[model samples]
Target: MKWSEICIHTTNEAIEPISNILHENGASGVVIEDPVDLTIDRENVFGEIYELNENDYPEEGVYIKAYLPFNSFLGETVEEIKQSINNLITFDIDLGPNQVTLSEVNEEDWATAWKKYYKPVKVSEKITITPTWEDYTQKSSNEIVIELDPGMAFGTGTHPTTVLTLQALEKYIKGNETVIDVGCGSGVLSIASALLGAKDIYAYDLDEVAVKSTELNIKVNKVQDAVKVKQNNLMSNVSIKADIVVSNILAEIIVRFIDDAWTNLVEGGYFITSGIIQTKKQMVIEKLENQGFEIIEINELEDWVSIIALKK
Candidate 1:
């Protein structure tokens, strides 16, 4: 099977509205590239941290890039996907040729192409995510290395949500605490919690891919003895209240599930809510406040923010 990708380059300013439009129009997968992005590779540390000039902004508006896989059911050729996307986007600029680029790849090509990017990703000053295929010999023995081979799942310590949660875990985690990683993608949060000294960690995800990915990650990281992974929605069958709850779900989901977040946290426990874009900040905050959580910090990066709160 061949996989095709569509690029809709838009501004950080206009991306969300266009994204909502595409999603409403039945687009499934979307990855964003901000105006600040000077280059391609998403994992590069240079362009991400480089100081920007004001001239980077589009004079008219932003770009919206959407990736549609190459499949017949997606209404045939890349041209068709582009037509549908254009209808939804209501934009004028053509992204050069290949309004939607279609690439043919066999299973082996897909496996290798994605697997190439899965090298060692250091989450914090201490923890490192090393795929089972990679070597961690450069680090000292005292360093905490999470061996993860995440395939078709969300978390891999690359996204800001996972990184912020790891930072929060390092600070808020105390000895012998029960941790619940709601929406645990690739088990990054759960493994980090266990490494940070949590007595028990329960990782749950609504997606089966996430559940399986996290389970594999736990086994690879040698935390299978301590961390448990299950395919379930957040707090569905949680019996013992947790000392720390970490959720990196979408802003609306966090708002909708704030009560469940509160229910999982013990008295004076910490809850970290990430995957929040800048626009939905107030809605999530108000919901958390109403649910008896006192906001501790709003950590921001690249127009994204993570809310860390404590149960009142």
Candidate 2:
């Protein structure tokens, strides 16, 4: 069996919403990423595992998800996903000038072509990601393991945003603390908080994919006991308060979301936010400061940054 991948570029924060739009329109599952991890899960002899896979992309990284039905035409489902996403979804296919793109399937004969791309990724000094099929070796007796397969609603460890989030998490999360990860993509930050010794980690996102992906990832990482993954947009139904709130969102959303993101936190709680480019860092800082959250630390890696603050 084969599937035609539909590549669409949209706001990173909106991918989850778009995935919901696609699922409602008849797409079974979607792979959402900045560089577009077309394949997130790899089949194995034992069962299944999660890992990244290779897909070709030309200029302007995509937040792509492929949808297909065994008996459907490529344009049928593709257009549905496109329409649901509306102007938020833009195509690589340009109608003017002589550019037309055709749908293609994976040339690999093996059913589990995605397995080849599954490999270990370093998340932090004590944490590493391994696909479920592979054995766990070289893990320290006291170290943390976050088992994840590539099939998730959000980007994986390979992305710079995730890496920067992990780095900030390592520094900020601590023992027995109550934490919340707003816009918790794939539940990585919430899982890391649990691993770093947070007791109660409440995570939710606007996308149902985020809720589902986070549930899967929490189980895979064995942090289910510590991490509570739910589907919510900025703490709609969560009754408990948090000592730390971490949000990885676009700068504009960060500015808009901090009001609610902070409302759920305890007075002394820390709010760590990323997905801010250099151009928007100052605006985020000023916004957070205006909210009365003292700026404790700001980390910059490449063009990405994570801001740490305390509710005063």
Candidate 3:
């Protein structure tokens, strides 16, 4: 069998949404190669940091590679993906070079190619995300390891936004708190919340694929009893009052659901938001403040920002 490798030269800001487009178009696997990964000083406190090849990354911006089975409808699917990606600009997302190319590859090569980019990394003080294929043991009893199969999903929980969100979750969730994970891609946050001692968790995502992906991952982490997966728009018709509401999505979408989030949280409950670029940080902060949320902490990783706000 043969697979077509589609590579897109795009910006960091566009990674999440563009990856969603590819996933929607039936991409088998997605690999993101960012030059920053080669230069960033990762703290290998409890896990091994895999070596990255400099030549595999783009000189500017980033390359998103996806594999799709070569078939008769391949051309049409690619066009749909291109159009969907181009539509992102209306949301004020920067597409960068936005150059896309394709190549032919054998099935076996592309099947495992994306795995090399993944490894167990401690995203937060207590949480380490490793692919399901890796064997990771906790160096300390306090350390939490999340097993994820990210090939069928959008996020592997290693991105800066996710890391920041996970770190905030670790800090806020003491124990027995009810968590609402808005836009819970790959169900990583929900699983982390459960592992960190949240008694009950409700995970929601608009995309059916994401909903399924989160469900699968939650079971893999053996947190199914604590986490409930749902397919719903962000906080829409969600009346469950939560101790903490965490969302790792676009800033534009995050601001739209401020009221919903407010209503869904108990008084003094927390709202954790990420997937916000540095340029949009002020906008999100202002929105949260205007909604009567007290900004507790704003952390940045690789120019990506995450905010922990208290609903006072």
Candidate 4:
């Protein structure tokens, strides 16, 4: 089978949103090549050695690549992706040089090429996200390991947005609390919640691939009993009141369901939201506040922001 590689050359600020656009359009296994990474001083802290080739990266900006099956609709898919990315500017997101290009590749080549971009890394104080194929051990007694095979899911559990949400979950989740994970891509948040001592977790995503991926990942992490994966549009039909509701999705989509999230949370319940670019931060904050949620904590990592709020 043949595959089409869609590569977008944009600034670091646009990486998260562009990656999301690709995933939403049915592209799988994204590869991010950031020139900044070539200049970072790793110092060997994570036990992984870096041997980067400067020529492989763009002279400026980063390149995000994803693979989609070569089909009759490939042209339409690519155009829609471009339009979605162009729409980001309205939210005040800075997309530098937004040049897009495509190429054809063999299925075999894509199967292994994207794996090199993933590795085990500690995203928070206790959580370390490791790909299913990597070998890693806990460096501390309190360390929690999350094993994931993201497959075609939107998140690999290591993105800053996801990391921020996990950190917030660790800080806010009390034992035996019920948690709802909206847009539970790869089921990482729900799995993390269960591991953090939540008695029950409801994981929801509109994408069928995400639903299946979450189910598989929950089983991989041995948290199937505690986490339930489902296909639902945000919190639309969810009727259970939860102690905490967490969502790592676009700030625009996050605002659309603020009322639903507030309605499904018990008094004093927490709402943790990430996947917010810095530009849309104010819009999301205003929506959460308008829904009667008091701002509790606002966390930022890179260009991403996570806002934690409490029901008033």
Per-prediction TM-score: 0.68, 0.64, 0.71, 0.71
lDDT of 3 by residue, 1-312 (tens): 998989999999999999999999998568999998888887653234567779999999999999888999999999999999999999999999999999999977756877766788877777888999988888899889999987645756788888889899999999999999999889999999999999999999999999989888988999999999999999889999899999999999999999999999999899999999999999999999999999999999888999999988
For all candidates in order, the CA lDDT equals 0.71, 0.71, 0.90, 0.90
The residue pairs in collision within model 1 are 4-70, 8-64, 8-65, 9-63, 9-64, 10-62, 10-63, 10-64, 11-62, 11-63
Model 2, range 15-84, lDDT digits (tens) per residue? 5666777677677787655544444344331122344434454334455555464455666756655565
lDDT of 1 by residue, 176-272 (tens): 8998888888788888888878999988889888888888788877788889888887777677698888888888787776788787778999888
Q: Which RMSD values do the candidates have, in order?
A: 8.2, 11.3, 10.3, 10.2
Clashing pairs in 3: none
Poorest 10 consecutive residues by lDDT, candidate 3 = 43-52
lDDT of 1 at 53: 42
Q: What is the lDDT of candidate 3?
A: 0.90
- Global local distance difference test of model 2: 0.71
Model 4 vs. true fold: TM? 0.71
lDDT by residue for model 4 over 1-312, one digit each (tens)?
998989999989999999999999997668899988888987542325477899979999999999888999999999999999999999999999999999999977756666666788887888888989899888998898999998854557777788899999999987899999999888999999999999999999999999999999999999999998889999988899999999999999999999999999999899999999999999999999888999989999889999999998
lDDT of 4 at 236: 89
- Cα-lDDT of candidate 4: 0.90
